[model samples]
Target: MLTGKKTIVFGERDEISATATSACLKAAGAEVVYENTACFV
Candidate 1:
């Protein structure tokens, strides 16, 4: 559903769900970016 879309995922840590979501996005041909919550600290 998210083809050729850009997305950013922010979270405190890289959890299982986060990883799975990223994989799903990639499979759907999306450019996924990840940011850790600690970066804002």
Candidate 2:
């Protein structure tokens, strides 16, 4: 489990999955910097 750690999640295509992961990380005491949903062509 992550505790007092910083993280950034990029290019998460699924909204539910992204939100869930962010929530889990925060609950585990992680500082989520950013969550991006955009993709490059």
Candidate 3:
């Protein structure tokens, strides 16, 4: 469980979008500071 932590997510565009991924992280008690869904591939 991540509590009082800061996390930055990038390019979570698989089955779940960036938002959903961030939400899941938040649910796990992580502080999602930034979420980027830009996939440059």
- Indicate which candidate wins on lDDT: 3
Tell me the alpha-carbon RMSD of every candidate.
4.0, 3.0, 2.2
Q: Which pairs in model 1 have colliding backbones?
A: none
lDDT of 2 at 23: 84
Model 3 lDDT, residue 1, Cα: 55
Tell me the lDDT of candidate 3. Answer: 0.78
**Model 2: per-residue Cα lDDT at residue 22:** 80
Task: Give a tens-digit lDDT track for model 1, residues 1-41.
Answer: 69988888554444434566677789999988763343333
Alpha-carbon lDDT, every model: 0.66, 0.73, 0.78
* TM-score preference between candidates 2 and 3, better one: 3
Clashes of 2: 0
Cα RMSD of predicted structure 3: 2.2
RMSD of candidate 1 to the truth, in angstroms, is 4.0
TM-score per candidate: 0.56, 0.63, 0.64
| True-vs-predicted CA distance for residue 41, candidate 1, Å | 18
Number of clashes in model 3? 0
Q: Output the worst ten-in-a-row residue range by lDDT, candidate 1.
A: 32-41
Better of 1 and 2 by lDDT: 2
User: Candidate 1, residue 37: CA error in Å?
Assistant: 8.8
Q: Which one wins by TM-score: 1 or 3?
A: 3
